[model samples]
Structure formats: C-alpha cells, structure tokens
Target: MARSGNVWSRAGVALFQLAEYLHEPGASVGYTLANWNISFGGSVAMGAHRSSLREPSMVAAGVLAVDIIDGNGNIRHIQRDESSDEWLADSCPSGITTCTV
Candidate 1:
C-alpha cells in the first residue's frame, strides 16, 4: 500500500510539472497576430492567441484568419469575416486601430 501511494504521488508530481511546463509563457507550439500590425512578444502560441482578437480581417483584407497547423507542418486558414468587428473590438483594447469595414 505504501509503495502504491509513493508511485501515485510521483505520478501526480510529474503530471503537475508537465502541465506547468505546457502553460508556461514560452511553451507554445505556434504564434501569429491575426493582423500584422500588432506586435507580438512571446512564444509563437502565446502571440497567436493574443493577436487573434485584433482586426485581422480588416487589416489583412481577408488574409488574416485563425492560426491552425496542418499535417504538412503548414498553417491552415481558419477564416474570419469582415463583419466580426464587434467581437474583435470587445476582445481587443480601444486603442487598437478599428476596422473600417
């Protein structure tokens, strides 16, 4: 029983460490700003999530979309509409440049 408890404890600790590492600021798998105008400062994954809320479609003119990776190690388009300005404004700060759409 004591041995089992030790094994469980070690496993829990290992899992916790793994989670912490995954959540760490620099541990992301990819990164990108929906709009190129926004500057990013972190691992690729962190940058992607942070920039995903900006006026990607308006700035990029439909080129800026969600970040996704495909089996070929390439980023796939996630698609964003020009009409989502409200949601983008809500997610991004006011100082950010608004989409003219």
Candidate 2:
C-alpha cells in the first residue's frame, strides 16, 4: 500500500519476541492508515521477507509524499527524484528505529 500511496512509511519491518512456541511458526502484521489525496514528488520503494522451503514469503512496498519541515515550523515540498543540500538525512529515508510495530 505504500507503493500505491495508501501507507505511511516507504520502508518498515515487523518484530516479535524470541519466546518459544509449540505450534508451527508464523507472524502477524496489522495497522491503521489515514487517507490523503495530497501529491508530492518521488518515492523510494523497498521490501524484504522470510520463509521456509515449503512456505510462501511475502512482499511489500510504500512511498513518501512530503518533503521536509522548515526551521520555522513550515513544511517544504520538493520534486520527485530531486534532492537538495537542505534535506536532513534523518528525514529523507525514514526507517524504523525500534524492534516493534
């Protein structure tokens, strides 16, 4: 849904505890997203997955629409595939920094 403009971040990963289970292994991911028709430049689509030889692996993708926030609490918008010296490294590639959803 990120690639299709229906998700928030372009890249994200789900995490679970390392506890032992007696049944077959599996993971569950779920979330709520807001709707917006706003358009902006560029997107960085990426994904990853894991599976056993007999199981199916899943694929995912997403995008970014807003540019950056200014020093005076203003938001700036930029063209697709375009970058400037003003963009902050922490914002452009918004990656998850935690081990849980």
Candidate 3:
C-alpha cells in the first residue's frame, strides 16, 4: 500500500486497519465495508460495498490506479482515466497479483 497526498492505494490490507490509519478529523475513506476484518483485495474481488445504501458495491469506483503484474511478470500501472475498459475489468476487480503493494 502507498499514500500519496489524498489518494490512498492498497493491494492487500485489512479494511479496519485502513480505516484506523485514515481515521481523523475530516479524514475518511468515504466508502467502507461493515466487516472490518475483510482484506482490501478480497473486498475488491467480491465487489463489497459500504454500510450505506447510497453507496455502490463496486469498490473500484474509489480507486484511481492499480499496479498489476502480468503473466510474464511485468508490472503494469493502469490509471482509471487513461486505461482501457478491458484492462480495468481484468486487473482491478480480479485481485490477481504477483507483486507486492
């Protein structure tokens, strides 16, 4: 996981831990799962949602970019706005990774 400015990034981490780290006055994750023990990668794979009904379950909605390792062991960084639909759908939601956060 990495923290750059207000854009928090994660590959594998506990949801509660992430929440704790982001917890502070005026600092929040915006959307989170009710089950704190769930891992970030797992949640993304499961398409987990926040407790609020207004929020959607597509966790990728909050993600700005993702670092993925291809089958050939290549680290490919994909940005939300600049990436293709196929790349985003295949990499972000699957939680398939051969690289560390």
Candidate 4:
C-alpha cells in the first residue's frame, strides 16, 4: 500500500479481497472484474478482463512487475517494460506473479 491509496499484492490474493481492500473511504480500482473470486495469478494467466474504451481492458496497467513460476518450476522475474512480459501484461489480465509483487 502507498500514500496514494495504491495497493499491491501477491498472486494468491483474490479479487474479492482486493476489492474490499480498495474500498477504503474513497478508493476503487479503475477497472473491475465481475467475479471477484478469481486469484490474481489465474486472472493474469487467463488474460481475464473487461473491455473499456476509456479505461484499460484490465488492471494490468497498474502492475509494476511479476515473478512467474515458469514451466520448469523456476521463478522468473519479469518487469513491466520487458518486451515479452509487456505483451503479457497488456494482453494478459492485471496483477500477478507468485509470492511477491
């Protein structure tokens, strides 16, 4: 969490929890998914999202980085600006990774 009300979480965190956390007095996510039961990692891997012309398709725009567990069971730290992960973040859902933000 930050002074600006921006909060970051690990992949295990569920959207429901995030929604609740973001529900501070006057804060909310720019984009929201109807089903809040999904895990952050699941959302990212499946590219879950909602369409919007003004706002982004998903909350992925807010993600700074992701540490994904590759097929080999190794943790891969991918930054938002990396070409491939950039595509992943834009094309994928929103926030994700394994244990860390």
Measured by lDDT, the strongest candidate is 4
Runs in model 1 deviating more than 4 A are: 1-44, 47-64, 80-101
- Backbone clash count, each prediction separately: 3, 3, 0, 1
Least well predicted 10-residue stretch by lDDT in candidate 2: 32-41
Candidate 1, residue 45: the lDDT equals 23
lDDT of 3 by residue, 7-48 (tens): 455666887777777774345555675467877667766667
TM-score-based ranking: 3, 4, 2, 1
Ranking by lDDT: 4, 3, 1, 2
For each candidate, C-alpha RMSD in Å? Answer: 17.4, 13.5, 5.4, 5.4
TM-score, one value per model: 0.17, 0.24, 0.66, 0.63
lDDT of 2 by residue, 1-101 (tens): 21211323222222221111111243222221211121111112112333334443322222234344555666566433336433323224333431110
Evaluated at residue 77, the lDDT of candidate 2 is: 67
Weakest lDDT window of 10 consecutive positions for candidate 3: 92-101
Q: Candidate 4 on 10-86: residue-level lDDT in tens? A: 85888777767777754665566646788765665566665677866765655667676666777777767746744
What residue pairs are clashing in model 1? 30-44, 30-45, 31-44
Q: Indicate the worst ten consecutive residues by lDDT in candidate 1.
A: 1-10
Pick by TM-score: 1 or 3, better one: 3
Candidate 2 accuracy as lDDT: 0.28
Judge candidate 2 at residue 34 and give its lDDT.
Answer: 14
